[model samples]
Target: MKGPVSALGINLLGNNVEAAQTVIWTHPKKTEDIGYNFTTTKTITREELNKISKYIDDKDTSANVLAGIATTILTTPLKPYLSISSGIGVTLLTSYRSTNGKLVSDKLKKSTAKSFKVKIAYKYRQTGSNDGYYFIDTIKIS
Candidate 1:
């Protein structure tokens, strides 16, 4: 028997056929935003720090400061039982104090970095009482 003249001839004799084209379909991806956490470093100039210190000192005597103090007093009694919220109240009260501002300014004044890391947490709405939205859960500076 003679060998096939060509591969194309062999394919033709076998009645074999090949696809001439191909098609594909794709869809866009969807994303859901539930929550996120991130850390960012912020630089503060001496002038800015001084201004911030002054602002805090001024606010220290404001009604909000009194409210914070009252909140602390009311929450301290429940601190042992409800540590989370009570601790938050105490932290808020301390944050509104000139002493805290002085301490922070002094500490940063001695350092060359003059920068702080801010940790921010965000949360999405949970229930039907309100529309879905994002809000900051907490901001911690170090």
Candidate 2:
């Protein structure tokens, strides 16, 4: 296929791609189904944070939301689109205060981790066709 590269945009550790009707699998007699799946997330490390900060040197803070919600979105990326790629995302809770004014703490029962997944797709097109790019298979590649 040669129209545009595509991939499953959002991915979790273990979840269906979309509203699953059913996925049928049939191996062509002459070809091997050489596709596999895996997952990765935006589990941040102190070193990574340091590197990021050091590179930018606090130059721009206008779009620093990623740092705030990295842990939540780390396991997901933008939904499928042109030139598909992987990324991390997160859903952040502003504070540990419960709706009823109860206090919660990260050390007690909160997870501050974020992550997303990367999927590798096999983009292909017919020998002379550029408008029919298709993905024969896709696998997770951290």
Candidate 3:
């Protein structure tokens, strides 16, 4: 959480396949305009975590602290054993002020951030044995 007048980004997924995320912020000291908002969605699969593109609603398209995000349709690879994925994000937004909590950030600075993630079940036999996979009960671990 940033502040009372700012918004926090959080994501929740159902069944680990679909995700609902919100990226909204605010300038706490602004008297007339102090809102920022954007939404991001993603889907996790057996092989990758895919970014679902989104845009701001028409009603909020004219906000001061503008929020815009875009992600390529390509996928982020997931680890087989841990079922996890990690990637970085490069964002450009009009940031707010640190002192007065004002939406005075005039530059569209490029901000790069990394995000880390998980997914699925279905079995296929591994052919051409490299190392004999050890088995415990019915589970296989190499």
TM-score of each: 0.31, 0.20, 0.16
Model 1 misplacement above 4 A: 1-41, 50-53, 56-106, 109-112
Residue 102 in candidate 1, Cα distance off native in Å: 10
Candidate 1 lDDT tens digits, 39-59 = 223344554444434435445
Compare the candidates by lDDT and give the number of the best one: 1
Question: Between candidates 1 and 2, which one is better according to TM-score?
Answer: 1
lDDT of 3 by residue, 98-122 (tens): 1113221122112221332211121
Task: Give me candidate 1's TM-score against the actual structure.
Answer: 0.31
Q: Which ten contiguous residues of candidate 2 have the minimum total lDDT? A: 90-99
In each prediction, how many residue pairs overlap at the backbone (N, C-alpha, C within less than 3 A)?
0, 21, 0
Model 3 spans with C-alpha error above 4 angstroms: 1-8, 17-24, 27-31, 34-89, 92-142
Please write out the lDDT profile of model 2 over residues 95-118, one tens digit for every residue: 101111222222322334332233
